[model samples]
Target: MRLHEYEAEEIFSKYGINVPQGGLAKTTQEAVQIATNIGVPVVLKSQVLVGGRGKAGGVKIIDNLNDVERVVAEILKSEIKGFKPEGVLVLKKIEIKKEIYLGITIERTSGIPIIMLCSEGGVDIEEVAHRNPEKIFKLSVDTLQNLYSFQIINMVKKIGLTGKTLIGVVNTVFKLYQVFKKYDGLIAEINPLVITENHEIFCVDAVLEVDDSALFRHPELNKRKLNNMSERDKRLMEKGATFVKLDGNIGIICSGAGLAMTTMDLIKDYPSLAPANFLETGGGITSELMFDCMELVLEQPGLKAVLINLYGGINPIHEGAKGIAKIIREKKVNIPIVAKALGNRQEETWKTLEEAGVYVIKESETQKAVKFLSELLGVKK
Candidate 1:
């Protein structure tokens, strides 16, 4: 769940991180009131979930009270990347002497969190990484243990952060890490972390992304929309199923969480194969439940093929075969299927499915399911 800018700042402030004085405004009148309260020379930022707000004229700095209403009125009426402004963030504009970037995110391959520091800030980090990769410094931290003081010192030295500014930056990151861990966050950053002329360091911009799986730990965030979940998401959640929609032509239904995740990962290795979703049917799937899962997959748009991979352990292969065969026969569906029913009574399961004209693959042939599904979808390997 990505938090709104104002909300991120609010959460940061609770952990002793300094942020500009700001409030949310849904109307032009409310925006002017916030500016008046914070005093003039304030910045008005459009509070939309999408990016490129500044380029789209969603951000403006006003020094005069007369122009606050008119400028904010225009911003409120404008849209940024097809997203209408839910509100505008009214903040006291800070004069930045220097900008730095500090953030924590999980390294995909290593599956560990790392604190990243960059001297080049206020610009997209991705742009910096691509153009000036050496400018960014990284230090991987073990979440199970407390952060070492030496790690901070090493980062301070590596980034050339020195003196009072160095001292302040170290303390701020210490607190920011706590917020990151406490919330089961996926990524947290204070980009454009600024230094004022007076040598005071403040995080001018904040971003916090919490893992949806850990939302039960933070009840207060219930008000904030997580991934802007749609009706399909709501239904999947109700069924206690893990289904993440992806842009692809093949839809997958597998048993077991670990197996489903592995299947999706394997699918990525084949460029011709792309999965529409990660749907896992837990242990002991009933006929009705199996039908529900199949129906859900069929509803997905742009889907060209479906694969049912079952490693029958607790849920017998016969039950899964009966369920899928019933759907094919009753619905009279013509969509191609790649069913891999392994373990107990696998022979009988394949027989049942083959009678329904479903393409039955073997345990040894499971590895070729991706290529087969790709061909079913008419994608060149």
Candidate 2:
């Protein structure tokens, strides 16, 4: 549910936040036209989800039409952080007197939205926080009251804002907080919220990550999807399987989000194991859904083995085992599957797997399961 810069800017603009005029272009000619329309000294930015676009040569300054065409051609031809550049955002370049970073994200430990502001901008916020923690100001907003005016004013003052620009910064913070609450956003950020040479404040870059669970409430936001998903991802989604491809080779299928994440973390503990996807079948999933999930995992060419770790609380373990056996037999899948079933109906699940001649580890411990799966893949320890 991460949005592209243009998409995020559109949301920000709706909330009365100031953003530079820009348009998305799919071709070099279209990009050149957009630059010409926005006037000279435009910035050509690749609309990819990955970061470090400038370091990766996905961003360039176009002083004229020639630079526009040249830069657009280069950006469109480049790949940043493994994501192929598909489109370019041509935006009016501004003369910045200063750059600041402002963002809001859910705190994993506290389960609260934390607002972060820093005077250092135009760089990775994480790097800044890591190097100089004192410079970054953090405020946790109470979900009950949302963001208050005094809190916003305090944050701006902490960042040392002054004059009319201070008022603009305070207003932007208020508007951004409203947008975050309105959309049930997981994250909303404006990197390098810049002060122009004329003392006007504007968001130079924007990023928003809407909570996927909240998508049903916002039809308009749902339609504004960005083309950030990969070809395999699109295929998996179309097939009705909950799939999230990861950097590892071990394919994981669990019945809960907690278990799926735990499986991934356990795999990381072993040097030789890397999970390929975070596939959750969810509780009470039918045999058909199980078949779909298994098929999706097997579709990955790099998948070395499949791990089925289900603590069936609501779901009957026998049904899950039966589904796995059905998919394996019907699809003639060759990848090794290691099953670790626990919780209600565990005996029935083990019996079903044994009857089907599937590898049943009969372990409730996640670490032991990881060890067994790693060994099955010819990895020691």
Candidate 3:
């Protein structure tokens, strides 16, 4: 689950990472109070889960106390990317001598945690990496073992740091890594980790995302409401499934993220058809889980068709197919339900799906399965 900036900063601070003094405010009065207490020119940042807040007028500097109410009220009323502000973060603005980028995340291809540092900061790291690939320094870390201080010092030195400043930055990296490891984080980022004219380093912005599957281990996080998660996503998460809702009529249920994405892309090959959701069941599958998935997706309004793409592998997909069959019978679903069941016990899986009146595709190619569903739904070019 992704956290708001304030939440991330709180986690950072708790781990002994230097962060600017700030507090979360839910109203204009609270914002004004925070600014008054700081007694310095402060920045009011809208607390939303999405990015582009700075460009969207969700961030403002309050040099005068008189303007705090108006600025806070204006930001609170404005919506960014269809998401309203849950609150505003009031922080004392600092004079920055330098801005640096530091982040740690799992590298998908290598399946290793990669720590990245860049001299440039306060902007999208992707944009920087694409424009100036040489500027970004990377070190892939094995999370199973300890991250040595020398490793961080060596990487930081390449960026031209020296003396106390270098030591401060190195220490911050250590603290940030601790936060990442302790929280079961998918992403622990500090954009614009700043050095003030006073010669102190503070994480000016933070982005922490904990793995949803690992939430059960952190009860404090599991009970908190996630602003970025939709109700459907939450329901699926609770059921040990993950679903990404989309804006189309085809409901997609697949066994992997890659396959679900591929199915969505192929479904878009037909001009009038698009995926309604991307549902991934991961490795663990059961008849009851499949039944639950079908029931959830079928509840979506305007879903004209359902597509189930599965690869048996080590999973007893034939048994899971029983759940789909059960739900179909119970709901009396009439929409075109097309399934492409491949791999071990493919015949048994096909039989169970077919018995529930689902159109089973024998082709191993996903494109053909999508084309068949498109035609069945009478999708126009």
Candidate 4:
């Protein structure tokens, strides 16, 4: 789960990391109050889940009460990356002499947590890595051992930071590592970790993503949930259907998570099939659940087609086919549906779907099924 900047900063401050004084505001009046409390010359940042808030005009600098009202009103009335800005974070603006980037993320290839630091900050790290790979320095930590002091010093030297700034950076890096380990975080990043003219370092911006699977262990983190879930997601959960929204035209429903993800990936390879959602109907799917899943997929405004990939593992293919047929008969769905039925009771499953006038692909190969679905959906190859 991704955290908003204010939430991440709160966690960072708990670990002895220095952050600017800030408070959250939900309205223009609240923003004005926060600015007044923190004193003027405050930074008003829109609190949204997505990035590039500054580019999206979600961030502003206000020197007084009038500017605070104007900036807050403008931000609250706009949306960034499709999410409507409902609140703003009011923080004390600070003078910066230099900027740097610091981040820690799990490395799949190394099988360990990796710390990434760069002198070129306030820009997307990925872009920096692609355009100037030499500017970024990376260090992988052994999960069994704590981050070493020498390693921190080496990173500071590699970034070309010296003197008091280097000492402060080293301490902040160790504290960040502690926060990552304690919270079971997937990513903890501070973009533009700035140095003031007086040689004090403070994390001016923060972003953290926690491991959803490990949330049960962190009750405090769980309580900080921002209720930013999408409307489609809430409806799917209420209807007892496992659904994950995606930017595509083809709606997919499968018996297992692995198979559903693979189906989406394969569809992407075809250049024609665009998966709308990742719907996994865990074993023994009832007709009602199947119907609910289909209805949820259809509710997507841009959905163009439906792909049903069922492999009999623990789920009986015959029962699943019956459910699909029932949904078609009852819902009167007009959209094209392509079904690939294989394993347990395949023959019966095919017969049931065929009887309902649904296009049943009899191929065992995923690529062939993808091609057929693409054609049916009018996806150009």
Q: Pick by TM-score: which candidate is best?
A: 4
Question: 204, model 3: CA deviation in Å?
Answer: 1.2
| TM-score leaderboard ranking | 4, 2, 3, 1
Q: Show the colliding residue pairs in model 4.
A: none
Rank all candidate structures by their lDDT, best first, as comma-separated numbers. Answer: 3, 4, 2, 1
User: For candidate 3, what is the lDDT?
Assistant: 0.87
Q: Estimate every model's Cα lDDT from 0 to 1.
A: 0.80, 0.81, 0.87, 0.83
Quote the lDDT for 50 in model 4. 70
Tens digit of per-residue lDDT, candidate 4, span 1-381: 778898899999999999998788999899888898888789889998777799989988887777898889899988875567658989999888899999999996676999999998789998999899999999999998878999999988998889998999999999999999998988999998998998898998998888766877987776554255455455545544566656577889987877887898888886645787789876466666676677777766556778898888656778777778887888787888888989888898899999987889998887788888777766666
- Any runs in candidate 1 off by more than 4 Å, and if so which? 226-233, 241-381
Q: What is the TM-score of each candidate against the true structure?
A: 0.68, 0.75, 0.72, 0.75
Tens digit per residue, CA lDDT, model 2, 163-189: 788888889888888888889988899
Q: How far in Å is the alpha carbon of 32 misplaced in model 4?
A: 0.4
Residue-wise C-alpha lDDT for candidate 3, range 1-381, written one tens digit per residue: 788899999989999998877799999999989999986699899998777799989999889999999999999999875568999999999889999999999997888888899999898998998899888999888867899999999999988989999999999988998888889888999999998876799998999999877987988887785545567556556666876555578999998888998998898888888888778986577897798788878977678899999988888889989999999999999898999989878899999998889999998999888888878877756
* Location of the lowest summed lDDT over 10 successive residues in candidate 2: 224-233
Error of 1 at 317 (Å): 15
In terms of lDDT, model 2 sits at 0.81
Q: Name the runs in model 3 displaced over 4 angstroms.
A: 226-234, 243-255, 261-363, 366-381
Clashing pairs for predicted structure model 3, backbone only? none
